[model samples]
Target chain A: MTPAIAVRGLVKRYGRRTVVDNVDLTVMPGRVCGFLGPNGSGKTTTLRLICGLLTPDGGSGTCLGEDLIAGRAAIKRQTGYMTQKFGLYEDLSIRENLEFAGDVHGIADLRARVDAALDRLGLAARQHQLAGALSGGWKQRLALAACVLHAPRLLLLDEPTAGVDPKARRDFWDEIHALAATGITVLVSTHYMDEAERCHEIAYIAYGKLLARGSAAEVIAASGLVAWVATGEGADRLAIRLRDAPGVTAAAAFGASLHVCGPDQAALAAAIAPLRGAPGIVWQEAPATLEDVFIHLMRQVPDNAGQG
Target chain B: MRGTLRRMRAIIRKEVLQLRRDRLTFAMMFGLPIMQLVMFGYAIDNDPKALPTALLAADHGTMPRAIVAALGNTGYFAISHSVTSEAEADALLQRGEVQFVVTIPADFTRRVIRHERAQIAVEADATDPTTTGNALAAVEPAVARALARELTGPLAGLAPRAGPVEVVLHRRYNPEGSTRDNVVPGLLAVILTMTMVMMTALAVTREYERGTMENLLAMPIRPIEVMLGKIAPYIAIGSVQVAVVLVAAKLLFDVPMIGSLALLSAATLLFITVNLAIGFTFSTVARNQLQAMQMSFFFLMPSILLSGFAFPFRGMPGWAQLVGEALPATHFLRVVRAVMLKGAGLADIAAELAALLLLLGLVGALALARYRVTLD
Candidate 1:
């Protein structure tokens, strides 16, 4: 079967500056695709284009087997988009907001659907509470419940867990995976590296350019970055010296240890060999972690790489 | 279309419930009309009586006494002062203590006996044109009666021909009119028009500013459906305001509806729809609620001034009258005053009804076309 969402040379411009430059992407059903990008990148804009919220300036794509331009209304019918902000009525109760969403979708038996949504999201106990009174975690859950209440074919979430707690973020991701297991395509944009790692595949973008795209292991392997993890009394002092030295592109402190990454293996070894013999410091070569490779990739791109 | 209907119904239900929760908006919606009705009803009085005036009689004789008694009996002016000199009356006028100063000349009895035309100097403050006009008119009958009675009695043989002065109270439309009777009914339109336009204009724009409109627009709904949904509840509220204002008019100011109540309600309903449509159009275009409110006020100030609520529509200049005709409030107020006071029928009010309906259609279409369903 064709991929659930397939697009080629997609371009969206705002005035003279292109917000989403020429790009190609394909995602199959039942896969959780994490779109990672720095601030002002085109991840949200690309998602909006696919979800029919915006019309692209150039390109042709098929979303859910419909033409992206001509069939936007049809695509919107089966797509659920969760915005960054909490967009429900604060003066209304949880049950009322859910029912309102259900009615907006024109679902028959709206009360039953709302009740089922409440139960599925574990929100039954707080059904009568006003949406404004709910905690951040509960509000996140409510937003997710409203998004999925119609049983959409694809879900687009933009920074869904930016301010949410760690435990709540984990639970939200777990629910997302469960939804994907049922063949619902999920396109989620997030700032969290851990959340990106949890996805089946990831696309990293910066300055409106897609720099890297693949599974975490594939991206790390493709980056070809070698790293060494070091710990000791003077790791901070050592990190400061190693940052300016040759073959070291990214030098970061992870907790008490220093993670030094570079692309050239021979040069990396020669550069760190002197540091291993330094006093009050221990150094050893290690597999470059996703974050280590991720940082290395970000540093490699020129400052204006995505300007065109 | 069916989905749009469902969504609009849901939006209407939610908005109505939210309005019920906000106590301040609720109070303003219901209380403003009654307060304005009562305040304006009591404060407005067109035909003023018992104006205080001073008297300066040079001769303490029967003729002076007759003149004072005649002025007092007219009930239009009260003799608040009996001065010995013209200087005293001038002092009263300068101090603003008296609106009018009446001076009877020292040769008052001699002039009448000689059958000559004696003129009494009636000095009055013209700052308040209405009071000055009334006071000026009242002097005629009082002086005339005093002259006629004196000539027919003790000065009958001395004066051969003596005629009374004429006092004509010029009232244009509402002759023999009570001010409450005219103003209370006119205020019904003013109060409802102001609040209704403001409330409806802010309704949708507020949702847009609060970000709740994203949830509303994300649904599979058409723009017209959203517009209707937002305006329907405000229309219902406006009807209740109409009823309250009309009832207050009847009870407090004794305002009678010479025309059919059904006609008034029908015209008011149409006007409310037009006003709400204009507001919703403004809401759709405004970036924020504050801008929407400012736009509403911009529309409101001119509408109130030119709509003939406080000022006379016919008295306005040609360009001003044309501008007034452009406002929906102008036509609606005309319909209201005609139906409520003149007992005008459908045949008499077809032109105004047509104007309001045309405005409603234009605004409704414009609102739908301008309203965007997505953030883009």
Candidate 2:
């Protein structure tokens, strides 16, 4: 079957600086594709280009099987975009805002639709409260409700869970999964690894370049990261020293223990040879984590520290 | 189209809800008219009265006594003091104690009895041009009446030997010698322009700043439809203001209305729409509420000063009057004052209406063009 959203070698630039440098992405229907990247990694820009909000400097693509450049209006009509900001009327109540969103999208039976959205989001109790007076969690729920009220085929959420509590975040992801189960395609960009793991597939981008794209297990296994734990009187110092040692790629401290990583097993062993003694220092090999693989990937990529 | 209507209704409803919540804005929207009406009506008057003058009657004859009594009877002037010498009268004027000084020369009774050339020296403070003109005009009737009374006396004062005494007062239009009349009419322009434009500019811009505009723009509504929906309510409020100001003009200021109320109301609605369009354009360009207010004020200052509202359009130099004419408020004031005061008909005000309509069309089009339906 044709992919629900597909873009080929999209290139966009601001002035002379290229953001979203030549990248290809495709999202199958009924799947959550998490876009993971550091700040200024062009995730938001890519989303905008795909949604027809901005014209790419160069490339060709189709969104929902329509030529993106020529069919922007159609794509906009069927696409729900949630900006990072809370883009709802603060002075208006949740019910009023939802009603407005429904009316704007030309939804028939707006009152019923708004009521359904509020009920589905579990926000019926606070529907009469002003959006401005809502807490961060409630505001997040309201923003989500407004975005999904149109029942778009694709949902483009930009960092929707930022600054929200963990409970609220979990509840939000549950709602997103329910939407995905209904055959809706979701492309969400987030900085949190837990959220990324919740998606069916993850695409890691760094410095406007796509570094990796795969399922969680595939990405972790493909990273070739070897891990070891060190216990000692000064394990933190040992880890710091082992960072510059040959074959030691990453080093970090974790609660009275030190976790050291490297891509080559033998190199990691040889690198830890010096820490075998030194009085109370203990070194043992351990299982590598997804965070370690991502850190290793981030270390390999050249810095884009000042791109923003 | 149905979707657009739905969205328009949503925006209007939301705006009304917000307006109801913001009591200060509601108060200003309704209360300002009544306050300004009462204030300006009570403060303004056109009929001149109680002008200060000094009498220097060295003649001590029937003619000077008749003149003093006639001038005082006109109720336009009161002899605050009597001066023996021209120097004393000049001192009183220099000190700002008197506006006019009438001097009857020491010709004694012999000149009038001899029927020879007798002259009265009238020294006036010509500093304030408007007041000076009214004072001179007021003294004219008194001088004329006194001469007429003397000539018709039993002694039959010689009318043939008497020469006309010329009183030179400065300035013509609104010669009540009070700035209240001039300032009050101009105040209407200032108050309306600032309040209307600032209020409207803030209306849309607040939505943008508060993030509600994005929601509105996302709707299927056309940009022009949004502009119309926003401006219609202001036009209603503006119409009520017109009626209030007219009633105040008639009842308190005795400012007669000479033109059609219908034409005045029509012009006022056009003016409101034009101003509202300007404000809408500002909202489109401004980034925040503060910026919107600043931009509105910046635009209003020029329209208020350059518009012939505060100053006489003819008195301003050519380039300045050209600037004044460029503002819709200037033309509106001219049309309003003419229709309301001069009773000018449609034929008399057609050009002004055309200019105002042209401005409204241009501004409304520009506002629509400046509006964005989607984020870039």
Candidate 3:
């Protein structure tokens, strides 16, 4: 089967500086792809370009078998782009917003479709309430419901859960999985590591460049980052010292332990050897984490993301 | 571009629903016209009456008093003071306390009895020629009537025919000199332009301000579809405003409507569309709601001041008239006045209709061109 999304050499330049620089991407149908990147890393711009919400400065590709520029309107009809902000009218009732979405998509039996969406969201009870009155999590869910109101072929969610609670985020992931089960392709950008792990494959970008593209395990192994877990009473405080040391890409405190990773095992051990037996700390070699690989990748890119 | 009708209908319905919920803005759409009509009706007077005058009756005679009484009876002048010297009259005119200074020159009643060519000098303030010209014209006929009443039996043959030339002055259409007749019809154009353009100009900008424009453009709706959908509801609003002003003009003000109602309705729709198009074009240029409001205000100032609504169109300078000619309000004003007061047919106002159609086309094209299809 053909992939739902396939684009190469996609570049977007705002004046002199590039926002999405020569990015290439391909996602198969029914596969949930997590787009992970630091802030100002061109993730949102890439999603906008793919869904035809934005024009690419330089690219040649197809979205759902339609030319990116020529068939933009046609592709837009079949693709749902849920912006980072709640784009639905705030003053409108939840049901009204859904009905408006359905209407714009020219759905038949719009009333029934909206009612069904409301049922799925468990928002039928408060269907008449204004969307602005809902909490952050509920608002996110309503926005999600509106995106899928027309049963779009592709979903481009930009940070679907930024400020949502833990339980709500889990429910949102469950909904994504269910949609993916039905062969609806998903390309969701997020900063959360747990959400990144739930995706079938991951694409990590930084400073307008795609740094990694593979499954979470594949990306971590591909980074070849060496890591050591230091545990005991004072290991958490060692993160502050190891963070600035040579060959130590990331040294983050996770609960009572310090997870330190670097490019080479020899240099990494050399950086942490002096503190190995100091006080009540135990060191053990561990596999590098997805978070460690991402920090390493972010460090690799220069900090000239937005400059010309 | 496909399914444009469905998407446009959806947008229109959504706009109307939002308008219904926003009671204040909805009220403004209709209230602005009536309020402005009533406010300007009592304030503006093209043919000002009861202009203050100081009469220096140096010729203390029965004939001079009768002439002054007749001027007052014409409803044009009020002789408030009888000054003894020309200096006092000059001071009153200079201080702007009086619009006109009437001086019955120091002559005895002997010149009239001897049948000499006697002259009565009346000085007028020439500032604001419209007010002075109409009031001064009434003076001659009033003096003629007063002199005819005075020269009854003995001095009958001496009654001046003014000259061999006889002129019959006619003030057609508005005989009562009612300012409301001009104002009420002009209100239709002014109000439609104010409300239609500003409301729609704010509509698209409001979408952008609230960040919903991205979501909207990401749908199947095209730029033209969005423009038409945003303007459709205001057309109905413009119609309602016209109805209210027309009914009030007939019932409350007793303004005459000498033309066909059908022609007026058609012309009004065209004018309203022109304004909506201009407003939609403004929305494409403005980035936020505040900027939209400022742009609408900038457009509205010239439309009201130069559109022949506040002042006579012909009285303005040639270049200013050129600016007025380019405005939709100027043509709308002419069309409405011709149809409502002059009893003009569609053929009589064809030029104005053509102007409105051209404006609609040009502004509509500009709006379409400026509107962005993608977020880029």
**What DockQ would candidate 2 receive versus the native complex?**
0.47
The better candidate by TM-score, 1 or 3, is 3
> Docking category for candidate 3?
medium
Decreasing TM-score order of the candidates: 3, 1, 2
Which residue pairs collide, candidate 3?
none
Count of clashing residue pairs in every prediction: 0, 2, 0
**On residues B1-376, what C-alpha lDDT tens digit does candidate 1 reach at each position?**
6777788898899889889988999999889887877777887665577777888777656876787788778776787887888788889999989988878788877676676766577788778877677657767767767766766755677533444875576964456667776777777667666777778778888887887776565556677777788888998998898888788878867777889999888988999888888888888778887998898889888887898877779999999999999898889888877887788999899999999999888988898788776667
DockQ, per-model, please? Answer: 0.63, 0.47, 0.79
| lDDT digits (tens) for residues A1-308 of candidate 3 | 88899999999999888999999999999999999999999999999999888899997798998898998988998999999988999988899899899989999999888888999999999999999999999999999999999999999999999999999999999999999999899999999999999999999999889989999999999999999999999889999999999999999999999999999999999999989878778999999999999999988889875377
Backbone clash pairs for candidate 2 read B258-B343, B259-B343
For candidate 1, give the DockQ: 0.63
Question: How is the predicted docking of candidate 2 categorized under the CAPRI scheme?
Answer: acceptable
Q: Residue-wise lDDT of candidate 3 within B9-95, one digit each (tens)?
A: 889999998899889998898789879878866677788889888888878789888888999998989887778888888998888
The candidate maximizing DockQ is 3
The lowest-lDDT stretch of 10 consecutive residues in candidate 2 chain A is A299-308
**Distance (Å) between predicted and true CA of A32, model 2?**
1.3
Error of 3 at B27 (Å): 1.1
Query: TM-score for each prediction?
Result: 0.92, 0.87, 0.94
